[model samples]
Target: MNSPDDTHESTVCPGCRAVLPSSRWPETPKYNASPECAEVAGELLGFEVENAARLGYLHQLRIDAYGGQHVSPDAPRIGPVFALNGLYMFLERGSGNLDVRTAHGIMANSYDDWPRLVPPDRVGELTAYDVLIAGGVDEVESALLKWARQVWESWPDDIRETIRELTVELVPERYFRR
Candidate 1:
């Protein structure tokens, strides 16, 4: 019988389909007894492949909306478009745009066009841009929808709009360099 390590194939780079060795994956912190925390942690870490893929789709959509390229093949290597829950949510920035595995692709977003309503204090060590350009369109929509349908559901319609206007595209601005 195959061991747990051997039972499943190693995770490969979704962008390039590069076969990732077992050693290449991040060493997650040890798991405790609580299955709840483990599940939460996995969700947060983009370990859930389906969820990640959804988020990645959203991320790409947002980039495309901003006139950014979907995939920049020619740009120098930056890194893989991140996946969470099997979704491709965020792409690494390179050549002043989203870096795709393919060659000659250059994608960029208009940072200045984004609103600056996010509080400087709440921004913490991260900037407005950092939070905006981080995830794919689907992931971001999921997060926004979660907040809208769950936590902010009871909020006034105007309030919901206000909150979303500030936080909706947090990834691109947050991650994309000026």
Candidate 2:
């Protein structure tokens, strides 16, 4: 049996609490995330941007989902809203063809004010690490979708409903399928 002090040292990310390996990548100043989590996010972003054609809208989905899951005290409230809107559009409305950026623009312009949301104590068990470990474009995409769904479902029902209503009110019917 190993001594208490001899236990493996895994870095626990402040945002997601995912046990990450020793940090090889530098922490990003953009998000209020731990070094390890930010590094993993950076890697994922690099992969998505590098394979933009293959990932398409998923690139934006990953960004929003990650942002939603890792909201900090000082972080802007709109980040999670954007994440849920993206989730509603792609997962709920089946509007994969509708660009996430366009949807965000619509939301931004339609609503001058947004409600302040409280981040849950725990976001989701799946982290960016899970998607990165999938190791291929197809596998990564699958993992990413699963991650997004998990994050979306993790939010409270009321919050989700608010996003649904916002999407319906802000996004015109022409954007959705008949």
Candidate 3:
């Protein structure tokens, strides 16, 4: 019932065409949009959707035993650790808009003292450090989440919850809770 011009037509990622809301069609999936769309939507939305995709992929891998057998063998793999990595990477490298000012500030501080903030023991578990010299990816993600919540208590509820839910969804028990 909507005219072409009246509706803001935007191309959607084939990856998320079905699940995304109309408003989120062209939006970034990392923030509840689509994984493919995230890369072009800037740090906030892009990284958010990337995190979601990572969560989704991990959920499939661990709890659902799902995956894209067709994806290129050379392509990078996605998983729970990657979700945390994506979240941390975004926090460290994302561009901040006005709405994300506080979040950005928290991210900035974390970025500045990431190594010191997360002790060697913790880092060991979260990054690929042991194998790749980066340590454990889990510790970095957990620390990032903790720091984010502590520094920006006033961050929007749903946005924060989205991140939390995505992270939770990666857990085997909670993966399919929704």
Which candidate has the top score in TM-score? 2
TM-score versus the correct structure, for each prediction: 0.20, 0.84, 0.18
- The predicted structure with the larger TM-score, 2 or 3, is 2
- List the candidate numbers ranked by TM-score, top first: 2, 1, 3
Error of 1 at 8 (Å): 30
Q: Whole-model Cα lDDT per candidate?
A: 0.28, 0.77, 0.29
TM match of model 3 to true structure: 0.18
Give the best candidate by lDDT: 2
Query: Judged by lDDT against the true structure, how good is candidate 3?
Result: 0.29
Candidate 1's error at 138, in angstroms?
14
Where does candidate 1 have its weakest 10-residue lDDT segment? 79-88
Taking the tens digit of each residue's C-alpha lDDT, what string does model 1 give over 68-132?
11112332222111111001222223212233212212222312232222111111122112223
RMSD of each: 15.5, 4.8, 18.6
Task: List candidate 2 stretches off by more than 4 Å.
Answer: 1-9, 24-30
Superior by TM-score: candidate 1 or candidate 2: 2
